[model samples]
Target: MRDVTIIGGGFSGTALAAHLLEQLPGGARLRLLNAGAPLARGLAYGTQSPLHLLNVPAARMAWHPERPTDFVDWLRAQGRPAAEKSFVPRSWYGEYLGARLQEAVRRRPDVAWEHQVARITRLAPHAGGWTLFDAQGARAESQDVVLALGHFAPADPHPDLAALASPRYVRDPWEPDACAGLDRDAPVAIIGAGLTMLDLLVSLDHAGHRGPVLCLSRRGIAPLPHRDNELQPPAYDTPDDWLSGSDVRAWVRALRDAARQLQAPQDWRDLWVAMRARTPALWQRLPLPERRRFLRHLQVYWDVHRHRAAPSAMATVQRLQAEGRLRLQAGRLQGVQDAGAELALQWKPRGQDALQTLAVRRIFNCTGPSSRLSQDRSGLFPALAADGRLLPCPLGLGLLTDADYHLLDAQGRPQRGLRYVGPLLRAQHWEATAVPELRQHALHLARALARGHAPAD
Candidate 1:
């Protein structure tokens, strides 16, 4: 009997586990491990607030691609009517994930599936298999293992903010009760102006926070809102001569020109979806220098367009802006210091010669997940790197992996039985973050593991 273990109970981990159950032969056993994150929800879907909606439409979120409308069907079965194009509450999607996992377990009772709530710190090779050491001094073994650790925490770039150990400072927005103790009447400042920043804004509104909100980032641009209309495939082909250039500036111009041809920003969304479908191919064709240049200059602009916000949530942000309750600043954080109930912030605005200061009751780090594994304080990656079990991508975006999702060792050789499937694949595939991309990886990995393809070494 083959034994397998998956660490992390988030969307990637849970989907992989469910697919594995169906693919593995009888008598094989599997274990699913999770620690602090809610089962099947992870950080993205852990929010219970009604305002936190899935950025993608309901029809495309099925764990099984063969059943493309499974999520919408599930909603109807539960007496909740939902359309294929509707953006539903994230909490409801979390419920769908939980139900799918339960169904997978129910169908394969002979597999001896189990869920363990524990945090893993280290992994070691043992007798042609692997042993995991959890936080409580417990150990578990499996013939094969997959590390679906999802996204890592954001890096604290500022030295002063990183040194603080006060209640007024929140390093992670997903932490339990992050905004619970905040003073409603006192102003709050957020360190990033991205998707996470938007989520926090919705949360504050739900809690009835009436104080002014401050948003600071190197680029003060928030993500554009998704259009309510259905998006169609590209109507015309973007000629090779038009987009064959390697310069990022020219590429941006080409996209804007294509959007203008469609005659509406709403049509731009469809154009974006088509471009995203080919992003991996386009990214792979570029040289390493060009990729680096794009990351440094155009990544933020691409992000704001690619990953959009829900219409209702976008409306909330617009409302806040109209009332002058929200402010966006483009600058770099210079320092932060404690000042009684409030914290003082110093920043140097872009294209300016002077520093600015502000005091706020609380500050949140919403810079999104840090892509560099070397900067991760977590013990998992460090241990793997120390033992030559894993190698960092050349761009430092994530773990280096081959085309088959097998992680690379320190010497840059693919290590079988040690697989990965999540946003970390961004280093190789530029569009790996969203569910549509991740589900393909999960299905392919599951099929490979079922065929007894794991390497003994």
Candidate 2:
């Protein structure tokens, strides 16, 4: 039997595998299953666009926590010198991660490592551990399983629009040639105004599409830009009761008051960094109602401030807006209709009852991944939920997992030998998605598995 099986060879899985290699018992067998994406790259880093850059700087993006400058050092070794704080193309980082994983594997021949290009459709628990099956009926048994499934495709925003199945509609922007065959001068509409929207904008510009573009979202707030030289803010002193309070509104007020005390406006970013480290604890302290309140009212505003964009990419977007080639508006999509040569989009501007229509040759869904587990079309999740093997979070954020990352079942029991790592951990830990957080989870989970501390199967 395989000692450990990681289903999803993205950055999370790859990083976990590397960490496992260091901690797994002698002569253990390990298996990694990926659904045809390049190992270590995954959707977030798989982009070939030169303009798609890392939101974080090189120095802080090292896969190994022990070597903080690994990524930056890799850049120099590749003859592509980058400063510690430079935001480089994401493809380069993908390459760096892939190379590091390969080096780790080569250094450890005692562990049997295997990677399969297959998607796990179902999982069955057995006396030995768990049996994971692919669509083709192949199966593998492992004592432990880690679901590093990363992000899912964006869910259909509207039933009617999704039913149309028109060629003009682009459901997955990350798909190859998603922007191909577009009329260079025809107008286009992007359905969200977050980081994905910014990437799509850069892609359109790269493809020489100069047509008018419309970005529609509820808040219409684009991500703030990172400073070229990010200054480290002074250490923030947290009050003893900060995490003890259950009131999200109170926490917001406290944060705002603290931001006001910052010596410089840019220091707010550093303050956010310090606060981010404690977000998971703070989130847990919130009652369910307060958590919902934060999501409904403050999520967008928090995202814009927390997840800033690369300065260069933001500059390009600003340039396009200044030239009237791109427009950002706060609105709600009402419907879409085929208008002979183009698609007519009906939307109501924020705070206005009058409906407005815009004609566009193409519509791209840049709303990012679908977080609601109930909306997950992936058969694996629904099947697991049906079997009482996993439970979706009550707030529809993601799956419910315990402190050790063991998936909690329908009856609130942690499943032995089953684990998860990735963005979905946001269900329990609100700040779990980024590299710094995910890497720590991967490392901790690896050490736990290696120590054989999980409950017996």
The most accurate candidate by lDDT is 2
- In candidate 2, how many clashes are counted? 0
- Model 2 C-alpha lDDT per residue in residues 1-457, reported as the tens digit of each score: 3389999888899999999988776678888998898888988899978889999888889998788989989999999999987989999989998899889889889889898899888899999799998889898889899999887889866665786554589898888788889989989999999999999999989899999999999989999988887534456666766545788778788778877877754467876877888888888878899999999999998999988899999999999999999999999999998887888999999999999999999899999887676665547888798899898888878888887889999998999989999889998899987898889999988988888833346
RMSD of 2: 2.2
TM-score of 2: 0.96
Q: For model 1, how does the per-residue alpha-carbon lDDT over 273-371 read when each residue is reduced to its tens digit?
A: 767767888787788899999989998989998998888888889999998999988989999988876789989898897989899988889999887
Alpha carbon lDDT at 41, candidate 2: 90
TM-score of candidate 1 versus the correct structure, residues matched by position: 0.94
lDDT of each: 0.84, 0.86
- The Cα error of candidate 2 at residue 10, in Å, is 0.9
Clashes in each model (backbone N, CA, C under 3 Å)?
0, 0
lDDT of 2: 0.86
What stretches of model 2 exceed 4 Å from their correct place?
A: 231-234, 242-244, 375-377, 453-457
